[model samples]
Structure formats: structure tokens, C-alpha cells
Target: MKAKPSLRPEDAGDRPPFGRSWGVLYVGVLLNLALLVVLFSLFSKAFR
Candidate 1:
């Protein structure tokens, strides 16, 4: 039998942001988008 090659190297830090996990970062971004939508809607209604 022959030895198989490795996929990932030994040194690798898979951090998303703020030292948090990927899922946490994703949720934060979604929440930020939702808040922006709400704010824009309010601003448009107030001006129009």
C-alpha cells in the first residue's frame, strides 16, 4: 500500500472575526442587516 497525501497543513488558524467562530460572525452580520433594514424603513417613512 502507498501513503496518502494530507489535505490541510499543520499550522492553520480558522478564525472568523473578534476571535469568535464562523457561525457567530454570520449571525452578527445577519442581525446587523436586519437592523439596517428597519432603520432605513423608518427613515423613509419619516421623510416621505
Candidate 2:
């Protein structure tokens, strides 16, 4: 009989797919959101 595979705490699935770390990804997302908000506010003010 074959033995079952085991799981480890050091698995790669726990890490970010591209960035250096999860914090970097979070920061990037937050920055992007802030930039979008600023641009939208500026557009609203200019159009009015």
C-alpha cells in the first residue's frame, strides 16, 4: 500500500504569489485605492 502525503507549515501556498511579502501587497493595494480616490475627487472638483 502507498503512504499518504504529509502537509508542512512551510508550504509555499501561504506566501504571496509575486510580491516580497503580504505586507507589501497590502500596502500596494491601499496606495492604489488612495490614488484612485484622489483622482476621482480632483475630477469631481474640476467638473463642478
Candidate 3:
């Protein structure tokens, strides 16, 4: 089978702000967003 070209390999020249790889950075961002959503939900419930 022939290997396909992927964007990941091309991303070698771009460095993430705070991690070794782009995937780690993405996961961190997603986790942070989830935490914020949870906090906001709690805050809304507390006021209601």
C-alpha cells in the first residue's frame, strides 16, 4: 500500500506555544474549555 501525505508531517516547522507537539496543545485547550463550561454551569445554577 502507498503511504498518504499528511498535514502533521508538514507541521514540523510550526511549534506549539506550550508543548512538545500540536496534539498536546490541542488537548490542553479542549480541557481548559471544558473546565470553563463546568464552572459557568455551576455559576448559573447557583444564581437560579
Candidate 4:
């Protein structure tokens, strides 16, 4: 039987496939909150 090569920490590249960034995520969350607020306001106004 052949033995598999051992993996090392350095074998991985510096950057991950998905990567990581906070700026875009923050903007997306803020936009979602704004849309939710607008929707809720419209519904409340319509029912009242």
C-alpha cells in the first residue's frame, strides 16, 4: 500500500478560497435593515 503525503501548515496559500472582508457584509446588513423598516412602515400605514 502507498502512504499519502503528510500535509503541512505552509502548504496552504495565504488567502482562502472564500476570503474574508467586513465592509461589504456591514453594508449588506444595513441595507437589509433599511428595507425591513420601510416594509414594516408601509404595512402598518396600510392597515391603520
Order the candidates by TM-score, highest first.
2, 1, 3, 4
Residue 4 of model 2, lDDT score? 68
lDDT of 1 by residue, 1-48 (tens): 899775454224566437368788889889999999999999999999
- Where does model 1 exceed 4 Å of error? 1-13
Q: Which stretches of candidate 2 lie over 4 Å from their true place?
A: 1-13
Compute the lDDT of residue 33 as modeled in candidate 2: 100
In candidate 2, position 16 carries an lDDT of 72
lDDT of 2 by residue, 1-48 (tens): 999687575564667768988899999999999999999999999999
Clashing pairs in 3: none
Tens-digit lDDT string for candidate 4 (1-48):
999897666554533334254566667789999999999999999999
Report lDDT (CA) for all predictions: 0.79, 0.88, 0.86, 0.74
Task: Highest lDDT: give the candidate number.
Answer: 2
Residue 38, candidate 3: how far off, in angstroms? Answer: 0.1
> Any runs in candidate 4 off by more than 4 Å, and if so which?
1-20
Q: Return whichever of 1 and 4 wins on TM-score.
A: 1
Q: How much does candidate 2 score in TM-score?
A: 0.69
- Best TM-score goes to which candidate? 2
**Native-to-model Cα distance after best TM-score fit, residue 42 in candidate 2, in Å:** 0.4
